[model samples]
Target: MCTKFYDSEFSFLISTTEIGNSQIIYEEFWFYTEFVNIFFQNTTLQEKEKERKIENVIKERKEIVIKERKEEKERTERKEKEGNGKERTERREKENLVLYKFLLEQLMNQRQKRNTPNNPRKNKIKRNENFAQKENEGSSSEEESNQFETQFQELVDSLMDSNSITRCEKYAELNHNISHYYLPIIGDFFDDTLLAVKNSLKKGSVEEQVLAIRCLLLFSITLEDAADEIFNQFEPLLLKYSLEGQNKLKIASIEALGILSYFITNTGDLDSSQKILRHCISILKNNFIPQNGGHEIYIAKVLNMCSLLLSLQANDFIGIELSGNNESDGGIFFEYIVNIGKSFLEYPDLDVRISSGRLITLAFNLKDRLEREEVVDSDIDVDAIVEIFNKLMKEYSQKVSKKTKTKQRAEFKQYISSIEECIYPKDLITIKSNKIHLEEWPKIIQLNIIRNFLGSGFQKHIEKNFLFSQLFGYRIKVESHRQKHYNKKSQRKEQKKNKKYRQQNITKERKKKNNFENQFM
Candidate 1:
């Protein structure tokens, strides 16, 4: 509290000092001018002038302190020699410490200087010196760490200068290297990269910023066993991105949070992680239908990423609800499912609206559970939802006129059914782009991802839908018989046509064989 108060008050104190000095300097400079004798000649008192000079000097000292503070903020290489003055200030640090790590070291150093320096006990001191020597060997390790960090930064900046595919591949190699030799140091790498990301973001290069983010994301792979530690400084970078990064960066930042929340498999407690996600969910929801059309794609895309993460997070949080009623349960896992569905089924952009089967199943299950919780079991029917889905599929069926471009129809259908194991209701298509038609949509290949995953009733529910239905299903026996019958008829017709063509060619080729035989006879 006191620190915050001091910081706040100090800002105003400096502001006042700066303004006062400016006025005094102006007044003094004018004292010897032509206007001095005009109207303000003897009005200026000597004591006031003297007071102004003193204020000016104090203000200059204050200004110097301000400049030094800015300089100090940049110099975190750590002090080999103590008590660096304004004259000895550096333009940049050889290595910027992880701010938390720096704080810990500072605390240790301050304790050593104030208390340990005075301790006496000559024999004990010698013994302690040997131990301290070994402990302080961290200086050498720290040196190597700093050097490696600098080289890595240079490598990254240079790699970023190359074309994107090369940059991505280079990043992949570096990431693999960290995984091999420097696993323990990966967390600090993420922290340092935050600075570069901030710089790129400020420069307004969205591509550079996102690429930097992906580089930072590579650290996630090494964090497999020690993923919890990844959370230490993640929120700050994510918050910075949310506040200042471009659209892609913001989405990437949210995805990072999702990675943290869900990646840990079984992180003991997830309540803290959940708080950060609420705002993200809100953002996803709000951006569902953007004012202009194409903007909706970005919204859906971000939501798609967000939903997968949320599902994983919620799964971790719910952790097998034992009670009969986990009404608001499955934690973020269930919420994630619905939000994902919201993106694919509810959002404006057709291309961004689908996910692979497993995710779709997860989302559909979430909607089912959420709906079932408030309704009577009879009234809440999966089949009805399926019917609605079929309707949506029909809506998505996209009827293209025969004149439509064959290539475009194929492309549109592929987009509609991009995710395998996706299922839709009896509709031929579910969504449409401005230039696309309905018949080109892929049939919703139902995968029953949730039921296949959960087993028991889920399987039954999904399988039952697939097995029955007159207007919507293809019966195996009937389809097979029809195919065989068509094959036989087509083969006979082809053979007949071949024989007739051969006979006509032979008739035209030579009547000479017959004429010669008749003459000889």
Candidate 2:
């Protein structure tokens, strides 16, 4: 009989043919169940593998997005930093520009105020006659002088400002441009300006004192006479600062004293110059000892001052005895300088060595001058100096190696060349078209010192300043084309006037001769 059977696990209907044949049907059903189970299991495993693959791809995508966000954030931060830096730089530039403009405007205002007419009668005078022209020119020059004095007074007043930065700026401006204002300031306003500077020197801070010292030196250059009372008044203070003050003040005071001594010598005050030289020598002797060797710069400055003073006053010291009993010998100072130079040649500091080399060169120059002057009986020993320099040259040449600094090597070569030049003197021609030939070491040193003092104004002074022209023995008669034309026109007018005067004299003589002949007839 046929029967319907249900398999719950497989959910399939089965028919039983017979009880005996049920075993085979059951076996077949079991096989189908196992196959279905295996198939379902395989499908489930495949679906799980697909799901795992999808999850891995999603995770990779998230990671990529996260990395991209991080990169974008970093880029934005970098851009912001660059933008901030640019902003800061721009702001500084803008501030500087503003300050520059303000200063320019202030200067313009000062100029306008100075240029404004002060005297109506002077302005009303017709500039037709030569006398009037001369008067106008003189008035204009006086007005310019007044203008400069006013501007200088304003600068000095500004230096007294409460703001240190403002004071510094004004001081720098005045110092840098002192050449322009020095002549005017030295006129009627000299006393007031001097007082202001002296006050600053006495009462102001270290920076102010330094600035005042520089200003004083610049003013000292404008002094026409060597025996100016200012020298006596300021000498003690300057000496005090040079000996007692520290750092920049001491250096400035020393340089000021050197320049003062130079001016004193220039003015032919050998007594004062010699005194200054002695003072400098005494300082050097005290400072050059091993105990004070740590102050190389100070020692160098003192050496430089001695060299400058000696080079300038070498002639005076050569043949003349010291005035007082303090020093008996005449040429002993020269020997002292030579000894100092010899001792300092082995100094490690470049400045000290250079200074010593200059001192030695000056000593040799002094000896050469003495020989040229036919003063053959001097105490200076030239052979010993030559031997020392030769040794120095050999030592320097041997010390040059790959490890040597480029600056040091170049300086050494230059120093050696300068020494050789001292031995065999050569003319050092300046670079200007109107060449200044410095044939002597003293002249070279003087020019160097003046150049350092005048800075940018050196060229201007060399061209137009009478003092510099005389000092360098350079006649700079720089006439512009317009000036030449005017001169030629004036010369022609003078020639025409002379011709008319000659013609009139000749006509009068002829008339007188005719009258005499008629009377004789």
Who wins the TM-score comparison? 2
Q: What are the runs in model 2 whose C-alpha is more than 4 Å off?
A: 1-149, 161-165, 179-186, 290-294, 319-331, 372-384, 396-433, 476-521
The sequence of per-residue lDDT tens digits that candidate 1 reaches over residues 53-163 is 999999999999999998886565344344354323331132223323533554565556556544468547855885798598768657665666665666556453435
Q: What is the lDDT of residue 507 in candidate 1?
A: 85
Across residues 1-521, which tens digit of lDDT does each residue of candidate 2 receive?
Answer: 78787778767776668887988789877987788889899999999999999999999999999999999999999999999889966854543443344345445545654675667665455324435766756675555545545666776777767776666666766676655332322433456656766777777777877887777777666544422556776888888888886667888888888887777667667766667777877776666764645678877888888778787766665543333445444456556677767787778776787788778777766766666766534465556665665565445454555444444444345445554564434445453565655666677777778777787766655655445665667675433422454465467569979999999999999999999999989
Error of 1 at 175 (Å): 6.2
TM-score of 2: 0.59
C-alpha positional error of residue 197 in candidate 1 after TM-score superposition, expressed in Å: 4.3
